[model samples]
Target: MKGRLFAPRLVLLHLVFLAAVVASGWLGWWQWERAHEAGGSFQNLGYALQWPLFGGFALFLWYQVVRMVNGTELHRQGESITVPSATGHSESAGEDATERTTGGARRRSPVPPPAPPVTEEEDPELAEYNRYLAELNAAARSR
Candidate 1:
């Protein structure tokens, strides 16, 4: 079983990115508010940029988290994933599709042999249950 905090490397990277974004936003907001008191236009630009920056960071972080949750091979064990700097999105998308298809195709169990039918006398409890079920079904259909 996985530990409570045993997040994969990709997930941890996303968390760290999220933390940096939050910290940067907080710092920017503090500086902006302070500069606004002193009447600086640069702080206005910084403040204006803050939301978009934070939003982009959040989107990237979300992508990483989704990849981790969906079992994308972002990293293996202690090694960092060697994703191509360009077109990484396509690679990840292909991996996601492949994983989903392969996962579904994996068989959980083999077909079992058919069981012999039991007579009413062989299992009184089963007979009673069947009678009760039939009664319930009849009442439902009547309703």
Candidate 2:
């Protein structure tokens, strides 16, 4: 399978994401109204905005997940995942890509050596441990 998104699993996943988005949005709306109806303090107002923003983020995440699963990349603008850098400028995904590319191909990590064959001589410690554990279990059962 080429992993296309017209399958049963994708349908189930879409349902889950949709439910999450709806639930978060409702919670956010409830919080906002609660703040308004209550004392109307700065803290309450901040909570109101924060909850709505969380709801918005959940919705956006759902959209992105669906798009990616359906063989499409996320189309975003000014979405810089900022790392705290000494320089004021932030690095981007594209910049990382360019930095890592060597010639026309990405560098391949060196393959590790094949593992040695198993031997029975190395297992005496495990056998002793098992015997100790069996002794403890037997003692506990007798008690």
lDDT by candidate, in order shown: 0.57, 0.59
Please give the distance, in angstroms, between residue 102's alpha carbon in candidate 1 and its true position after superposition: 12
Cα lDDT tens digits for candidate 2, 52-117:
677677678777876676433221222334343334676543433322343443322355333343
Tens-place lDDT per residue, model 1, 1-143, is: 13323467755866777777777777677766766775767757667567557757777867766666554332222222333324345233222222222434322124433344556998989878877877999999999
Clash numbers, per candidate:
0, 0
Best-matching candidate per TM-score: 2
Q: Best-fitting candidate, measured by lDDT?
A: 2
Runs in model 2 deviating more than 4 A are 1-3, 72-143
Clashing pairs in 2: none
RMSD of each: 16.1, 14.5
- The global Cα lDDT (0 to 1) of model 2 is 0.59
What TM-score number comes out for model 2? 0.40
